[model samples]
Target: MISEPDLVKYLPDCQFGVNSATRLRFDFRNSGSGERVRAPWYRPLCRQDFLRPRTAAMEYPLGRHNFLRSNNLEEMQDVLGRIMCPHRLSYLDKPEPLDAVINSFDLGNLVLNYVQYGVPIAVDPGATGDFYALQIPLYGNALVRSGGKTIISTPEIMAVTDPEAPLYMELERSTKLLLVRADWDFANRVLRDLTGGLLPWKLRFDLGLDVSAGRQCQWFTEVVNLVRRADVGGGMLKGPMWVPQLEESMVARLIQLHAHRYSELLATPAMPASQRVFGQVVDKIEAMPEQLHTEGSLASEFDVSSRSLRSAFQRYLETSLFGKLWHVRLHRAHLDLLWATPEETTVPAVAERWGLWEPLFTQRYGENYGETPEQTLRR
Candidate 1:
């Protein structure tokens, strides 16, 4: 077993309190075998402010004895935007190996605990535990490996590890990490619903590190600044409702951006044969409004049998081409009826412009908008 003195030397600056202290007490009870080990631990409490322009002061009490034993960053450009200043204070009498344990907490509950590993730390995985761990690597990369795969994470990339699965990470250099142990049920459900059910089975974020001078880079910077100013100690519920909503939206957008990048990589070229034929047919119909404008003419132009063109259009735009055309024309006619000058814009003129020369326009318009075209024009 590790000794307490060695652990104290490895401890980092105490952010919780100046006088906060840690001491170890032991109790040995005889079970059938020999003796059972028990230790009574108490952690001191402290408070701090985030000090940002946009948000107010957030304060919370925490103890080192309860740090990771209880519950739970990115790039200059990426880093500047994503994290607020994080502080941890601990008081322990001796050194001991940190063990994996089952723990749970509310999703928005704030804590003042920090982990300072003298060497790189590696975490082993377990079953679906109570808490969701949000790992922010402040300094060097934290290499996470699981399920036969590995990811090197830095301040640019943020990792949310599920306590349910086995997980471990090694750091090349000494590293500082912010571990937030949040409720799994709430975090999972909110994330799933907000993402439209497109997120992966696990939670992780790769905040790309390319912080060149650009609009995206600037936006990243703003996000980090916001975090820096945010009151981490203030529980999420006490804050404005918009705070959690905004956070969820930002996470969703980040996922979408990465998904799009992956999609572009997988996209293949369009078929030449299909493109050439479809291009010529669509072009002619769009150019000469007389011949190729109608459904029959469109079918002929495409050299397709009856209903084939409609099927092709459905495949391309998820709607019959003729129906889409009609919709567009009707929408334009409605707009003209609504906004046109009284004298210049009449029911008949609008109908003619939309290829609805007869009473069919009036009937359809009435069905769709609950009023006749003439009534719309008059209004």
Candidate 2:
């Protein structure tokens, strides 16, 4: 478990204070050669193939916790124009020292930023040449305009803009924004992989997202915050071990919550378990309980939607495919335990053979069977 202080070392020019007092600054200029640009903000982030070094003196924050206090509009325009979308900034009132605080986490393909744009400004509209940009204001309000349609973003609502569209914004005072930048190709790939390779030629997202009250919205918010905190706390995302899974989860939630051109295809009612594809899925799971399986992986194997597969299992088996898989593996592990000679086998060894590695497996197995694996072996 990495502490908040432990994360300080990863930030540039970090200083220590008492008890959780950690000051970190990430001057984007200092990180030379385009090695790392904090997403959505750093202009040259996406199209590295067409990289052009900027002569403008731009300084941006990529921080664990830091303040972006700047009054110079040129510097702000340069940073915002390059990193995010190119736009002309207009002050509704004299921009009184833009004091935006940032706590950002970079997860390779996606960048999560908890930023408060502390001043009011009007941004002119032009096509934001990026993949996907999602902005959720935590407080106050912002009017977002795109495709001649306007939506006022508040705490209960979020704006998910397509990269190809022209976007304009009028930010009110103290409007804190949580911005998420995801790669367009990576997002579509996940969707195609999830839906078994059936997708439209072009994917377009609805500009506004209603997250006022719903289970899906709650789950999406929870995971986003969890990932943000985890990244800030322990650098959990810095390693490859859990990054792929976490990124997929985040992207999956976005696809679910936002309405896009192919939303109906994804939301199509699932087929019955009596379907041949569903039966084949169950057969595969039963025959190879130890094989690697996930909702996406299994759906792809049977050339069906993961949602449909899940619904089929729920309708017929009264358990999720994942739940059924767990029981099958457990039953297999039990058989292995029974057959193993006392000197040759241990509970952990048996568990490992069935893809139930210790620590977690022991607890889960105990919960299901009301006894530890060793106790089961003794029987």
TM-score of 1: 0.34
TM-score versus the correct structure, for each prediction: 0.34, 0.60
Per residue, candidate 1 scores C-alpha lDDT tens digits across 80-137 of 1122122222213243332211111222422212333433344444332654445554
Location of the lowest summed lDDT over 10 successive residues in candidate 2: 41-50
Q: Model 1 — which ten-residue stretch has the worst lDDT? A: 55-64
- How displaced is residue 59 in candidate 1, in Å? 14
CA displacement after TM-score superposition, residue 40 of candidate 1 (Å) = 37
lDDT per model vs. reference: 0.39, 0.59
After best superposition, candidate 1 residue 348: deviation in angstroms? 59
lDDT of candidate 1 vs native?
0.39
Residue 94: error of model 2 in Å? 2.0
Cα RMSDs, all models: 22.0, 12.6
